[model samples]
Target chain A: MSEKNKSDMLRAPFKLEYDYERSTGPIIGKFFEGLSNQQILGTKNGDNVYVPAAEFDPITYEHLSEFVELPETGTVKSFTWIDQPRKHHLINKPFAFALIQIDGATSSILHMITNCNESDIEVGSRVKVSWSEEKTETIKDISHFELINE
Target chain B: MSEEKKDHFISPISLDYNYTAGAATTRFLKKVSEGKIVGQKCPKCTAVYVPPRGSCPRCGVATEEEVELVDKGSVESFTIVHIPIPGNPIVPPYVCAMIRLEGANISFLHLIQEIDLKDIRIGMRVEAVWKDKSEWDTTLENIKWFKPSGGDDIDPSEYRFKGPE
Candidate 1:
């Protein structure tokens, strides 16, 4: 096609935005507040203890109200090494997003694992949450999980 | 109750979308960029739609027949926006009107300019004003605005589509 003909084609930027705000309700609200105070919390339903505080019991379909304080140290349930990181990823360097089961919690939470080589971490590896210096009651408060040598 | 109120947090969100104009819309926009208006006619109801909707909304059938329409049309309804909203394209006190193009049964909403707000009426005749040829593109933005067509006042009954009986 000619240059002038191609120039005739139209293009414009469009953005879809919500003008309103969203409120994180009670269960998830407490989870965020705990992160702000450098604490980790979980919700308990009978025998199953969920880290990151589930709003309802996944198996029972009942409202979960019991809050369990969990230790920062956890074992990696499963992990995958990312060779190249995308722009949206929290860490620019190669890292792993792993399912980590915290101490005293039966269920695992998905979070980034860093501060170690791809070969140094695997299933059942011990890791601890590296809290961010600046916390604002969001998931980013827990910067990433680092390998516990001991 | 007080603890619940203190724990609540507000989250702000924004999103972006890119829509690919399908075959029917592409054809309609191309014609409009060339300073011509076209509509798709419903085979079942014979109702013509400006901006060429691919399907007939009234009959739930695909529209295939293309019909050229006149630039002049009558305003079916309108609202004057006075509230100042963030990122609003037009200023307050501007008129946004639903115009039923001549020979088309359906109405499309667009900005009505070059007329006083107090003088605007439901059946006021308006014509599409094209932008400079250099700025023309395969988009509806080619039409700068709809101005008064200087035609006689059209009765509401004349532009109203009586259902397919």
Candidate 2:
């Protein structure tokens, strides 16, 4: 601990751990259950159907229980390319995180687009769900979306 | 917005990080390892900050001049915590005080014990109670807590003399 080298430092390891436990309730709980079975479900609000099922109508705010089975296919409405994957990313290689407009649905689902290069995907590119072989009743059941055209 | 209420989702979230102390803070903690307390003086505002963050948060100037401090201090404020901290051995109803160490401009939180809960007050005189020398390390935890030292309590105005907000 000399004066000349007092500034030379060591970093201490810090871990913040806690249990994130809560009830997903009915609407979101049913949505996750649908994913485990490889089913795409949405809620019908008049003419517009929202994927990831909204519990209430967007306009009238009425309780919505009428569910619709949507097709797995979708079109990329907007997207951003990631050249390098970070530790927490699901995909190990370069991928695109795109806002997809699922077919027969009014809104978009933010999902990953993999197995394609930077120029191979765009706003209008068609893609479909690539299901994980091991489903966990969570969002990851849809492993990622793949280019339906290429 | 009410929905169907059932089914529990229990997920454990955790993050591992490395916090490297800055030059000023590293030196301050090192001093605490040797049964001493230190503060860094800000060049612009001239405020002495204990456990310095290497810069003046108010004046936005670098702090390098180090000032060795006495272990004695005054309780600037205090609160009795009735709720127990998870995994902690200390029982609730214990006093946690904001202590401004002698020669330090800012107050820091620390446990105040060895006195009755009713006796705790603002501007009370207290001194650091250190653990055994062999168990010391580069941690402020080396000074276990502050205890009533039976001296003149600092004038309440002394701690309230900081420049304008």
Candidate 3:
């Protein structure tokens, strides 16, 4: 048993490619359809209405269907710096990923932060939706999240 | 049961992927239809790759030459797929293995046959049993399975490779 032969037995390399198709259920369907119409929809959970219509009530885990519209401008509740990105992420470069709570909405949506440096970003920062010139049914149609000056 | 008893509905969704072929794998699959085993040799490292490969991981260079390998090989590792993956073409309870064939430096993954799950030994020798000539295709299914290579259980250390039974 030579060391060279042992190494070969241990780690044999192979490559595999797989194709995956995900079914967007009714909840996500309505949200994407709303985005296509240039209108944002939210779900009403008791007294609070949330944007990007929540799939289920966070507390009760109930299917939420009540819909409402909210202003595009929002406040950043929490944020993180994504230095190294993975495939299908919103942005490729080092950018801040933020949780934005739009006005008239209780819950928030996760999106990327843009046009601001690491020094400028804070948890309580104000942000606005910079919609894309080419609108699509996908979430990226919102373009990039812009930092709104206080 | 009245006139309004028509309460049945069904829906079905099917998807197909136009899979692209890689360099060495394309050649390997082509040979399988002709009932042959093929391998690729690394130009820099000199290690032979079964089921072929585009590049040598060690040398980081494209494998240039095509080489024919022995249909017989020793199992390196194997798993029984008891559960069926949805939309998989093959039936369940099939054995998939990484076999270290003679003359090839690396192993290739394929199915093994003519042996039971309990009788399978890690160091047991096995030979490729090809499918009927009429049933050959550009797929790994051409080699039905590796059966006992006509030898009794030998010392694991004496054998060059110890594949999963």
Q: Clashing residue pairs, candidate 3? A: B75-B163, B76-B163, B113-B145
TM-score of decoy 2: 0.75
Ranking by TM-score: 2, 1, 3
TM-score winner, 1 or 3: 1
Cα lDDT, model 3, residue B68: 88
Structural similarity of chain A in candidate 2, as TM-score:
0.90
Scored by lDDT, the top model is 2
Tens-digit lDDT string for candidate 1 (A95-138): 99999999999889899998789999989999999999998788
TM-score of 1: 0.67
Point out the worst 10-residue segment of candidate 1 chain B by lDDT.
B3-12
Residue clash pairs of candidate 2: none
How close to the true structure is residue B39 of candidate 1, measured as C-alpha lDDT? 91
Q: Each model's TM-score? A: 0.67, 0.75, 0.50
Q: Which residue pairs show collisions in model 1?
A: none
Q: In model 2 chain B, which range of ten residues has the least summed lDDT? A: B1-10
Native interface contacts retained, candidate 1: 0.47
Question: For residues A8-96, what per-residue lDDT tens digits would candidate 3 score against the true structure?
Answer: 33222343434445444566656766676677788888987877788798888888888887777898899998877765566777788
Runs in model 1 deviating more than 4 A are A1-13, A45-48, A59-66, A115-120, B1-49, B52-70, B76-86, B89-97, B112-139, B142-165
Q: Pick the candidate with the highest DockQ.
A: 2
Q: How much of the real interface does each model capture, measured as fnat?
A: 0.47, 0.89, 0.00
